[model samples]
Each structure stands twice: as C-alpha cells, then as structure tokens.
Target: MPKQAMENLTESMFYVLMALQRGDACGAEITAYAAQVSGGAVRLGPATLYTLLARFEKEGFLTDAGTVGCKRYYRLTAAGKAAYEGERARLQRCLDDAARAEITAPASLTKGDARDETARQGNRLPSGSLPVL
Candidate 1:
C-alpha cells in the first residue's frame, strides 16, 4: 500500500492491475480474466492475488465496489488506471524497440523474454538502460 511497495510491484501485481484497467471485477473474475488475457501463462493464486488487491485498495489505486455473493468486486481508481497505462506504455516501447532491432539486425538474436530480448546486443545498450520518460 505504501508508495515504495507500489513501485516494487511484481509481475502478478502488474497483471492484476492491468486486468482491472479496463473495468471493474470481482476477485475470481479478475483472476480468470487475467489468466485469459495472458494466454494462461500467468495464473494468480488466491492468497497472493487478494493480498495485492488489498494493498492496491489501501494505496488508493483501487476502489472496493462491494460484493456479489462471496466475491468482492473492485474497480481501478483513476490513479490505478493511470499507473497501468504507464506500465503498458513502457512495456509497449520495450516490445516496439525490440522488434525494430530484430528487423534491422545483421543476424538473428534471442527471441521473446524481456531480459533475453533486451540483453546487450553486441555492445549496444539495452533500450531500457535509461529511465523511461
């Protein structure tokens, strides 16, 4: 819930935040949607997922919109959505720059995986070497 905690968010936290970016959702629904959107690569367990949700709610990044049955629904607050958008944009640039490099490269390099994709390319610095604007 603290600023430092928010800044140090994990990938699962990011996925949950991204899932709630578009609309409100209950806990189970949020998890389901996140898994679907991520092509089943990221699955959020109940404890870890809800803890992050609670922290985000406390941080003012999310709004608790009450419950349906046993499910607690949440909507991203304006701040939460903005953070998600910022992360999304940053990730987009990473993808775009990597693609451009691959296209213009003299030879093929490692494909996929952010670290591998952005690893130093023959003395060329990584795109994310500088702070994202």
Candidate 2:
C-alpha cells in the first residue's frame, strides 16, 4: 500500500505548523517561535525552514500571506489545521496507550482482576458470558 501523506509528521513539521497556528509569520519569526515554544529544543535552520515553507505551500497546508521587504510571510490553510489536529490526536492516543499499559501491567494483573477491571471500565460482558481464554 502507498504511504499516506502527513500520516506521521516530523518534529520539525509539527513545530512549524504549531508556530503558524499563532498567526502569520516570516521564516525567521516561525523559527524563533518554534524554539520558544519548545523551550529551545527545536531550532530550525534557515535551509530547513525555507524547505518546509516551500513544501507546505506546495501541499496546500500553508499560503504565502504577503511579503515585506525581503521577508515572505505565511499563514496556515484549512488543510494545515486538519493536519495539525490529526497529529495532535495521534500523539494523545499514544499517551493514552502508554498510561493504560502502565495501569494494567501483567505483573499487577491476576485472572479475576481482568474481569473486575473491565467491569469498572463499563465493558462488562453479559452475565454468565464466558471470558475469552
């Protein structure tokens, strides 16, 4: 099967989209905002930032808002918002799975405990229904 576009965004792509969420910004401004938001963990080089801007524009995730002097500004399009939301939900699911695993570690689970836990989560089977072995 063909790989999906934007199914998995790189850290740089995520931060870049996040930065644009604030408002339209030039390349330098976007890079600075990314660094600030990530607590200096994500610093986009000029080349990387430019390349991302170009790709995003081509993919309809961003639009060239305008230009001032030599600086070009960009704004997020609806496609960009969708991509950002999709990434956010994907990350949240990862966190939820990790937390669920931590709470249900094999070492802490016993035979009957699984049934009790399922009941607590409102997933109780019909009365007298056999649990899958």
Best by TM-score: 2
lDDT of 1 by residue, 1-133 (tens): 4465566457798899988876888888888888999899889999988899988888999998888888888989988987787777777898999999888864333454344454554454666775232
Give the alpha-carbon lDDT of every model: 0.80, 0.90
Off by over 4 Å in 2: 108-133
**lDDT for position 67 in model 1:** 88
Rate residue 116 of model 1 by lDDT: 48
Model 2 C-alpha lDDT per residue in residues 1-133, reported as the tens digit of each score: 8768777899999999999999899999999999998999999999998898899999999999999999999999999999998998899999999999888878536455777888889997998988874
Query: Candidate 1, overall lDDT?
Result: 0.80
Positional deviation of 31 in candidate 1, in angstroms? Answer: 0.9
Best by lDDT: 2
Residue pairs in steric clash, candidate 2? none
